[model samples]
Target: MSSDNPTPTPGGPTRRPSLDETGELPRFLDSATSDEPIGNVKPEGDLAGRRFPLTTGFSALVRNRHALSTLIRRDLAVKYQATVMGYFWSLLEPLGMAFIYFFVFGIVMGANDKDVVPGSDASFVLYIVSGVFVWQWFSAAVTQAANSLGGQSALITVMKVPREVFPISVVFARFAEYLAGFPIIIIIAATFGHGVFGWNLLWILPAILLQAMTLVGIGFMLAAGNVLVRDIQRFLPLVMRMLFYGSAILFTMDRVSDSGLGQKLPWVTYLYEHNPLVVLFQMHRAVWIPGLAPDQVGIMSATFFAVIMMFLGRWVFYKLEPRVLKAL
Candidate 1:
């Protein structure tokens, strides 16, 4: 080698990335910026920070199930640690709500005397409690999930675990609370009217599973989205409140399905019947009460909706992940 053209040494100044290699100078600069905080992610290459497929994300969750469990436990402990009643607070909340709704709608509104559901002897109390249980699980999982990522900014910055685990963990933890409260529903069913055990009772398992899957999907989307838009956190509670009224928590689906409203607004009735959470709630109510069987079509529809939401949430989460990290 000539003196003017020295051979490249083992240790030398790093070469600046070429346009072909970096793709865009601004992106390269953003990546190079020292002020950007280190997070659970480290981006590189052409596909760095790109969206992952649903299968890939789910498999990652399955593979990291232990970490997910730990997160779930930690979340539960932290949430109730300060409270005197601890986890029992979960049962108490819905119990209190059940009483209030039972008094207002069941007594004052004369739901106690009427069969809110056709062909069943279940009172309005039984009807409302059943729906309230489902709502508690669904609403808690989803609302907490919306804050899962943003609330754990410290963990996001330090933990190298799969990001999806945070939101899914919230779902699992709230599910534990749901399970603890399930006995109350069973006791109410047996004490208030019919016995809880029956052939149709087997259907509650699938109903719960389908609802969990749907919530997981919502969790993924909301968790990722809330990281970017704090407005999502503020807006979710109002949405959940609206869902409570619209989901037939206080009334019977049959009323709307067979009423003048149904005749005039057939499309509205269709939407309500097909609403996945509505289906799940009605399925829960049916299996708990005597003389009713869950609508097989509703169960099937809920399953399909859950599958679709899972796909949608996974797609949206991965799509927004790169930007979410930056926003957080």
Candidate 2:
């Protein structure tokens, strides 16, 4: 008598047993296939079809907060591993730059605190050091975040996590380093007789929030764009260098107005006033030098741009993610 199960000949396709004989569908038939749709089963490559609401990216970030913290820790650990004077290097580089700028502008060119930031009692050293510390974070975050996705292609492709985590982690890591240097800033301020305790210190919170928003927005765009076009990673350094000088790191907007450049070239000062970096720098410096506090117009402009860049960055990142994954 023939058995119910069909035996296949060597090198031949086995016939699927009938449901009556097996009492159930074959394993292959029971499983969903690419050609057939199943109830509530999302299609392959469905990311393209999903609606990208304004909160989608932020919601993903919120859901993946633990993952973000892990990434931030890993990045910090990798950055400091196998290095002597690890975190101190972050303080040293900016401190060194502050010294160089102080020498060139304060001594060589004879620019004084009164001349650079008029009406501010803070010494020139305090002014430059404060600006340098913050600028270091800004520069490092932008540079690292731009290349964050490209450098970690292996992790990004293998891990099923939000790609934004990489760039945002870099921003937080650099911000941590920035915060680490605060004691030094405080020491400098105290030494110069510019008391750090004042109502003006309240401004630091909003200043930091605005900057974080700006950097996150910029990071999203740069990280996604770099994956698509590798040239972005190369071109960013040049742009950053230009931004350093134009950002009023070595001087202040007050000095610019005092020099009458705004009158001679109204557009030049207008651009200077509107540049987010300049506005951000002013906000940060205003904490120590209250005279440098930005007017209502500057604050409003910066706030508007920060909001726009954030939403715009998320939109671009979402639009490009599909192509980015393929390119990766």
Candidate 3:
């Protein structure tokens, strides 16, 4: 008869085979007893050999939707922890930014909506507040997502969840903040006498979807790249500063076009209009200032850019995942 336990040697005590000797269990399962460090152990079984498709990030998020939600909640809680105002900070930051910009451009500089925005009766305050609100979400998401992987290296190493969840959670958490601030934007628009109700409001949905898609794609690339090259984390702030001025957040594309530089170099306006954020900000402003909306060609081009970035980001992430794991 055979025994379930290891058999005793003739002269020595019984001993079970180590995972390395047996080669029956996956290497990852042997981490507890293995002499090698956990971080150095390469994954085995499905994790090691599985082939991921281009939709892997999307599919992973969907399959682990519950985990993703829990992560988002955890992030939100951690972010506002020890704070008295908590969630209101999300609304306050962008609102405060709007106030400063309104003071500078609307009052100090005397920027008129009729001339700067053109065809929009909305005041300069509403125009800038609307842009700032959405831009806050984009900026926060990108900055947080870029560091998500490295920041939670220990959790990521231990958790069996999808790696993409880390960056995606940051994106959604900022998105939650974005949604929370929408009411403030509405109140400002209504107070400024900009009509908030109309079929044009439907444009907000696509604008949001496009921005989310773009952010997720950028998040994937930045998250992975930051792990490999630590300089990304250091250098990102400067890039964001440039993007803030270039993205039409504080000024309209029309304002740029009417400027002396734009008039002297017409291609400058063309390049500025082609910026994805320009189109996205215009779409967002379109909710109240319909004339600020991008044309069909601009909309299509932005959509194409979003789609391409998403695919490319996922591919880069997975392709470099092994190296990222080793680095972590």
lDDT of each: 0.75, 0.77, 0.79
Model 3 TM:
0.83
Best by TM-score: 3
TM-score-better candidate, 1 vs 3: 3
Candidate 3 C-alpha lDDT tens digits along 246-312: 8888776667888999999999898789777789888998888777778887898889988988888
Off by over 4 Å in 1: 1-56, 258-260, 290-294
What's the lDDT for residue 217 in model 2? 90
Q: Write the number of the candidate with greater lDDT, choosing between 1 and 2.
A: 2
Q: What is the lDDT of residue 120 in candidate 2?
A: 59
Clashes of each: 0, 0, 0
Where is the poorest 10-residue window by lDDT in model 2? Answer: 28-37
> Where in model 2 is the C-alpha error above 4 Å?
1-56, 193-196, 258-260
Structure candidate 3, residue pairs in collision = none
Pairwise TM-score winner, candidates 2 and 3: 3
**CA shift at 128, candidate 3, in angstroms?**
0.7
What lDDT is obtained when candidate 1 is compared to the true structure? 0.75
Candidate 3 local distance difference test against the native: 0.79
TM-score of every candidate = 0.80, 0.81, 0.83
